[model samples]
Target: MVPCEDYLVSMIDLPDDSLHIIFHKLESCTDRNAFGLTCWRWLQIQNLARGSLQFKCSHRSSISDNVRYLSRLLGRFQQLNSISLAGCTELPDSALTQLRSSGSNLRTLFLDCCFGITDNGLSLVFAGCPALVSVSLYRCNVTDVGLEILAKSCPTLERVNLSYCTLLSDHGIGALSRECLKLRAMTISYCRGITGTGFRGCSPTLAYLEADSCLLTPDGLLGAVSGGGLQYLNVSSLRCWAGGDGLASIGAGFAKNLCFLNLRLCRFVGNESVGTIAKGCPVLEEWNLALCHEVRVSGWEAIGSNCHNLKVLHVNRCRNLCDHGLRALQDGCHQLAVLYMHGCRRVTWVGLESFRMRRWGVKVRGEENVSVGPSLDQFFL
Candidate 1:
């Protein structure tokens, strides 16, 4: 048998191709770092094998030092195809210019909360990264010109998130919708400037959208759902002139593929809107109606009769929801697994106990430790 030293030497003598295969199998950074530290050859191979880099700088670090360090890392990791500088608030436009060297290989870029990156920086970086497929710029200082540049430069983009990018308007969104033909998922939440008119030219490949707190209109809402392929949508707190009419139109037009919806804090949603959703969205599995006090007995009855596949429901603070509405749900939604009824003052203890007796498996939440005495007429059914 050979000595232990000889065996170690033989293991290290493996070909570079064989070592590259082993290096990629290492899922932990610690293990990969240890492998790289084994020798100079191993370190060079590890750098070449590295495809993704995530650099986060602490607030205590000097901005110049952070930029210098990141520039060195970009120079060293020449094969990197994905880069995430999320929450690196101090990074300026000059730091992104370092990307010019490796931009051709990059496919994913995330610069969330990097306030210093403006339209100029975006124009500088995107002109080089032609193969980019996914980009997220949450809370960035980018405006319509920057977005227009991105749309025109990267035709292969498939997923983008511009949430809280306050400077973005309908013009930017319109450019993105018209240019990015392969885009599938987009999040524009809290973009108050967008009135949803840009979505009229949205790509048919787009299926998932989250535009909560946007200033939407009936025509805009109609254009978004008319595609008949949307599966996930969240328009909570949508600011519209007549929200009830917009919601009713959504139920009437795009009821085919919807699976998840969040309508929380929509003050104008009334019985007609809820009833229409119940009848239209038959495959609906989850619905949030919290703080919607306008829904009465008729709306609850409609939900119970239709939404058979419903598994989760939130009706918190529904003042008009009493024993009648509770009974309708308990009798109909057999697939119900979770229910939230925290502030239903009109629902008495008797009704709650009766519903619990019928559906003991369901998780009833937000109604703990409350006294509902028989003498109290306020809580009486």
Candidate 2:
């Protein structure tokens, strides 16, 4: 009685189908769930855009019953393109098997950090989602045989991330190199056993690669980066015995068209490598050379001078740098919005305070830099 008419007037009269379209645009699954429970029409959002599905069994709010209910609700819609079962430990094998056999047109899948999933459970996805373009299997205990089957079957795959997957090694990577040709990106980070030889002859169209901790040498890794038109690369924690020549190969092969490059902890690269990169990649924006022990001020100066459009740079923990390097960065890289100079003891507050006063937008976010100290030998070096 107290303004029921006023509330009704505020609500716009739209068709049920129109309301469904508005809710489907939201990327947040939580918001989607809330909207679905709002009204009967919103609950039927699957009829419009069942593009991305996330089966999160870890969250108590979206329990096992909720997943089952969702499967039933989505059973009618056969056009789902992406499915993310990040933490569904309680999800039965039968449920996944049934979903796959239903002829659902799923293409992208993310099974990040899901523990209950075994090889048997994963096999269902390969047989079902034959048109899959991207797959992320982080923290899963996938073995070589399972990987072979997936690589052989999923020929249309564009990207695959196997980060922190302990069981995977050169065996799986070699198998993939032989079979999968459509892959554009692959991440084998924390796979300690895989050497450089296993990554050869992969996709030529590969644009993104993240092999942070693999023992890939310059030549073996260069095969994947050189021939391909790569745009993003992260080869952190790599140890190359090829010396200056190896690091030079990185700049020679990969720098062109590369937007984001991370050579973190690749301890062998020196000033020569930096010079090559500056000459090769002019449009490079974001770079992380953190802990690359051999980098010097000359290298930093070359980067700053050449990569004028660079926005983000991280040289954290490189002891070779002095105030000269920081000054060069400030002088050349006018567009630099963020800088990480932690562990560079030679870099006094002179250069840092200058940028701090101007508020060079060097504010940190996402993660803190805790390694603030450098050895006594660092300043003298």
Candidate 3:
């Protein structure tokens, strides 16, 4: 009789294409690694199929050794298109220089909390990865010089996240906006040095922006919105009341396309600005005005009157939002679907029940302080 082992069909006997399909189907890293260990042929197929690689520093190993190991892996994965290195605190210029030899296919690079790499290292690495399209340097020690070099090197860049990169300023932003015409999405949240001036004549192709907590001025805000193509904007926690005009400018310039707007934590935003946005942004769908205590009846009425497309509205913690505001929203905002009013102390159960009676299909979510003392019904009456 033939040996029993002869009856077993080896997965290695499958065609290379079939093996590649199997490798792609394995979503977990652990499963992929196990698949590669099946045989040398399977390992080669796994390496060829892999396009993205991520590395995190091992606390048990020395930094230098980890970098050396990383360099070796980079060489082995010559087909890699995306590379992410997180918490590589002491990663040196020489470590990234290895990409110069094997990063011809690299298109995406993400470095988070990699404090040691600077402009020189960036210049060297970008020179090799000229086709890079998306680069995120969160909390990296990079400045305007580095950004300028990146802009010039990779003109095809589309998405960039420089959040928490404190060293960058408007000069770097200007260079990027001028050079990368195809740029679409950018996040500069917590970047205090960027006052929005860098976006003076930025590409109209740019649409999504997150500038929360930045030191934004009126002129800077105008520059950002002047492109007239912004679809999503987040300017939360902006303290400069003068920039309120800039917020209103979004409705003027991006009226045709702006869909999502977040003005959360803007404590000083008054009725005038809110009214302007409501009158102009007819297509505005989702708006977050949480923590905006100054917006009263007029602002809410304007929103209900003009923002017919408003679907999701967040007025959480708005101390001044009373029965009238709720009634106006229920009456005019016909498309209103989801309403969040958490911590709204002034809205009584009677007003809320009245709103629910009218807009029974709408989902209202909140924790109003109704039982603290005498109800706010007397004030509304």
Question: Rank by lDDT, descending?
Answer: 1, 3, 2
Put down candidate 2 lDDT per residue, 1-381, tens digits, no spaces. 587776564223666677766776787878876876766666666455566566556455455575576577457555677777776655555556655843447777878876666777778878776787778888887778778878887888777889888887777887777777877777787777666556676666766777776777666676656545677777777744544536676578554877777877777778998888877887778888787778888898898788877877888878887878777777787778777767777778776787566655556332323322222123114
Model 1: runs farther than 4 Å from truth?
A: 1-13, 58-61, 243-245, 367-381
lDDT value, residue 289 of candidate 1: 83
For every model shown, what is its TM-score relative to the native structure? 0.88, 0.72, 0.87
The per-model lDDT (C-alpha) reads: 0.83, 0.70, 0.83
Model 2 weakest lDDT span, ten residues long: 371-380
Error of 1 at 342 (Å): 0.7
- List candidate 2 stretches off by more than 4 Å: 1-49, 58-79, 90-95, 102-104, 174-180, 239-245, 350-381
Candidate 2: what lDDT? 0.70
Q: Name the TM-score of candidate 3.
A: 0.87
Enumerate clash totals for all models, in the order shown.
0, 0, 0
Name the lDDT value of residue 23 in candidate 2: 73
Model 3 scores a C-alpha lDDT of: 0.83
Per-residue CA lDDT of model 3 for 298-370, tens digit only, reads 9899998989998888898998899999898989988988898888889999999999998999998774322
